[model samples]
Target: MKAGLFIPCYVDQFYPQVAIATLQLLEKLGVEVVYPPNQTCCGQPMANSGFQHLTKGCDELFVKNFANLDYIICPSGSCTLHIKEHLHHDRHEATATAIRSNIYELTEFMTDILKVEKLDASFPHKVSMHQSCHGQRGLKISQMSELVAEPFSKPGKLLQMVKGIELVELSRPDECCGFGGSFCVFEEAVSAKMGKDRVADHINHGAEFITSADMSCLMHMEGILKRQKSKVQVKHIAEILNASL
Candidate 1:
């Protein structure tokens, strides 16, 4: 099936590889993906900073670019969640609603719409998965720790299918990486401490790499890892899922 690809602005600027990997992985899985060049940020930065009123143009442009697609897929959960929860264009309300309802995070699309049971991929490394708040709590990509329900993880499930990849267990698996967009900019010290704690979980558990569906979270921990000058690296789950190494 055909789907419109929504690569987050940050991903396009700082992490194009993740966007490329997502495109490749989807194509590999028999999806016909189209990237709309006019697409921009889902106005998440403005909305998160309490200037949501400034996103009128952003909302209008987003709906214009993606309204025709049957499904919209994005690599970043934070952006996808933003659009899913806040997309509004007063003149195009119906189209905005459809875009919101049809948009899916990359992993959410894989495990739910694609219903992938296996993959022709390999990643022989000790990797730990970071359950990003947007993907987990917002999108319901995994079971909440507070809930006494049967635990499940769409990302973890996909990782398990990769050959030679060892999905490590974290001491506190679902902790936030403290990259609440502008929160990191405003609450510097607290955000750094929280990120350090989250990164430490993966390091102490001997994780060779940290993987998450949300690059914003990984980017936060990546900064912490760099400050510590450790050899650990952060990768979007798309990179891992699309890997042959």
Candidate 2:
């Protein structure tokens, strides 16, 4: 299947490697991937900040660039969730639906669409999983405990299939890492406290590396880890899934 890659602004600026790894994995899996140069922000930063009206230009830009495609894949869950949940055009219900239905986080794309049960990747390290709210909850990409459906899963199972990688459990697995976009700054005390606790849990479990589908959350956790002088490093699931060492 042909898929259009949607890289968020932050990913483009700070985490281009996630996008690169995502593209590489898709190609390795035999899926035709295309990156439209015109593609930029998903209008998420503005929309999530209660400025949905300001996203019109971005919305128009996105529609103009990717409206024709059926599968829109993204490395960052926050960006994909924002676009799927908030991209609006009253006169273009079809366009809105197309955008929402087509978007997929990397893990969902692999386990659901590709039905890829195994990967030829290896990483000899103890890893802790951070379940990002957008990927785990917003998109409903995986089964959440709060839901009534059969237990949803993609991250854990996929990682388990990889050779030499040990999946360590966090003390509070599903708790938010306090990176709710502007929430980090608006509630600095609470956000920092929460992030510190999350990082502490990972360290307590002897995790040398922290991994998640959302880089924003990992970035927040990384900040706290750095300030605390912890040795644990944060990595996106795409990087882990594409791991070689």
Candidate 3:
């Protein structure tokens, strides 16, 4: 299948390795992937700040670079959610619908489209999973509630398939990590408090490394962990799933 790789601006700079691993993993699965280098920000920074009007040029650039692709897959849930939720064309309704329908987070694409149940990867460590707000709640990629439906999972199940990897459950499994984009800066007090709480829970659970789909969230948590000089570490899910012993 032809896939358009969309690397968010921050991912291209700070977390390029995550994008690299994502591409490698997709290639391993025989995906015909193309990197649209002309592509840049998904306009999420502006849109999330309620200044979506400022991102019209960004949206146009995105549409120009990737509108012709079969499927647009992004490694970051927040970026994928931004495209699915906001990318629109006031003059072209069909174009808006096409972009919305084609966007997919990497995990959702692996589980839903690729139907990959197992992978030839291994990580010899106890790991904890942080469900990013966009991938878990916004995108509804996996079941998060026991009260509503039968227990379903894509993240945990996929991790379990990796040899020498054990999934550790967090105290508040579905709690937000407090890296809600602008929310982090605007509410620094609450954001840091929530992130510290989440990190503590992972440490208490004996997790050597904390992993999540969004590097933004993990980066936030890592800062607090480092400040406190905690032995625990944060990792992106791509780093975990792409691991080899």
Candidate that scores best on lDDT:
1
lDDT of 1 by residue, 128-160 (tens): 999999999999999999899999999999999
Query: What would the per-residue lDDT of candidate 3 be over residues 68-116, giving only the tens digit for each residue?
Result: 7789888888999988888877676587679889989888888888999
| lDDT against the true structure, each candidate | 0.94, 0.85, 0.85
* Backbone clash tally (model 2): 1
- Give the per-residue Cα lDDT of candidate 1 at 175: 86
Q: lDDT of model 3 at residue 153?
A: 62
Clashing pairs in 3: none
TM-score, predicted candidate 2 vs. hidden true structure: 0.94
Flag regions of model 3 displaced more than 4 Å. none
Worst 10 residues of 3 by lDDT: 145-154
Task: Return whichever of 1 and 2 wins on TM-score.
Answer: 1
lDDT of 2 by residue, 1-245 (tens): 78898888888899889889888888889888888998888777777678888888888788777777868888888888888787877677688788788888888888888999879999899999999888887877766776677975688778897789988976678888888998887899999998888888999999999998888999899999899888899988888888764
lDDT of 2: 0.85
Q: List ranges where model 2 is wrong by over 4 Å.
A: 90-92, 146-150
